[model samples]
Target: MFTNLLAFHSIFRWLVLAALFATCILFVYKHFTNKILSLKDYRFLQVVCLILNIQFILGVLLFSKSQLALLFWDNFQETVKLRQPRFFGLEHPSMMILGILLFNCFTFKIRNKINTKEAFTYFSKRFILILIIILSSIPWSFSPLTHRPNYRSLELTNF
Candidate 1:
């Protein structure tokens, strides 16, 4: 069950990224073209926010059930000394939560503003910032600080 959850979480990251990217592009196009914010645009934003919320829940479940997290708690000092454990135990989760908070803040701000142009401008900036945070927090293949599942095998391989 844990392995399945992990695999689902890993693959879902791509969907989050894709949705965010699409929303950002759409916002940019609409802003530049002087298009008014429509219901579709708002729906897109809501979907992206919903996806992030789901990812957060999955991450919390993984964190609680993970053996690595248990190890980190057992050996707090030593775990903090290592890159991979530190990233998983602290960095990744913290950054992801922070990104979600930022997204929520900007999303509410966008929703409240009556001016369409201003809302789009705010969304563009917020989306770009959130994307940066998400990208940085992700455990990319080349990242020495963290580890991720192997895409080819779809197995929960160790870092």
Candidate 2:
């Protein structure tokens, strides 16, 4: 079950990333082109928000079941000495939660704005902020502290 959840969480990240990128590009286009915000733009934001929420829930579940997370909780001092465990147990989750909070706050502020141009401008800035947060929080392959998963090794039969 844990492995299945882990695999799902890993694979789902692509969806979240794609949605975020799409939203960012759309916001950038709107801002530079002076295009009025459309219903499609609102829908795209909604989709990205929903994806982030789902990813957060999945991450929490995975964290609870992760042995690395358990070790960190059991012995913070010792766990922090190891980079991978520490990143998984604390840094990743903390930054992700922070990203989520920023995403929500920015989206809420954008929704409250009555002017289309004002909302577009607000979204452009906030989306870039959220994108940076998300990008930084990700455990990319080149990171010495963490490595990307091998999709081929994620066999369902192992679960």
Candidate 3:
């Protein structure tokens, strides 16, 4: 069950990433075009929230299984003492959560109002925030993200 869950988590990452990317683009375009918030906007936001929630659950399961909870302790050197464990246990989860939080902020802020200008201003800024989250969550060895998957497969792999 654990292995199956892990594989599901791995496979789901691609969908989450793609949805985020598309939503980011849509937000950016809406910002410039001053488009009205439509049902599609709500749907996109819902998808993002749903995926983040799933990832959070999967992460919790992974953490519960091993020493992951220990590595996330507030100490830096203690956390990075190892490689794979540190990346999977700490960096990836933390950054992903931060991204989710930022995305939520956008959704929460925009859901109440109907003013086109305000929506554009608010969501555009939120879109930028989401972009920042996406940028940070990317596991670029060149950047702060050190735990990114190198390749994506349609089917989950054991290796």
Candidate 4:
């Protein structure tokens, strides 16, 4: 189950990135065009929220089941000394939660009856921040701090 969740987490990351990228692009276009956000735009934001929520849940589960997290809990000083364990156990989770919280700026952007320009400015800035946070912390295969495969198959490779 733990392995499966990890693989799923890896796979779902692509979906999360794609959704966020597309949403950010739309927000940027709207900002430059000075167009009032439409119902479709709002719905797309809702979808992005849904995707983020799902990814966050999966990440939480993986974090709970992770050996690195357990090790981090058991020996905070020791774990903090290493890079991979530290990345997976602490840096990744905290940064992701912060990014998710930053994503909630859109919630306010859509909910309040603020000026459309203000809304666009607020949301676009926070969304870009969220993107940067997530992109930075992600364990891409090329990352110098830590690295993981670009993809993980959800098959029972061990069994």
RMSD, one per candidate, in order: 3.4, 1.9, 3.9, 2.0
lDDT of 4 by residue, 1-159 (tens): 888899999999999999988987897788788887666677778788889889999999999999988898789988899997888888999999888876765664565634455667667777777889999989999988799999988878765
TM-score of 1: 0.88
Better of 1 and 4 by lDDT: 4
Task: For residues 41-101, write the lDDT of model 1, one tens digit per residue.
Answer: 7777888889999999999999998887778878998888978777888888999999998
Give all TM-scores, in the order shown: 0.88, 0.90, 0.72, 0.91
Cα-based lDDT at residue 131, candidate 2: 78
Off by over 4 Å in 2: 150-154
Global Cα lDDT for candidate 4 = 0.83
lDDT per model, in order? Answer: 0.81, 0.81, 0.69, 0.83
Query: Lowest summed-lDDT stretch of 10 residues in model 1?
Result: 150-159
**Candidate 4 structure, TM-score to reference:** 0.91
lDDT of 4 at 7: 92
Q: Point out where model 3 deviates above 4 Å.
A: 67-79, 138-159
How far off is residue 95 in model 4, in Å?
Answer: 0.5
The candidate scoring highest on TM-score is: 4
The residue-by-residue lDDT of candidate 2 on 20-102, one tens digit each, is 87886777777788887666666667778889999999999999999999999899988889888898899899989999888
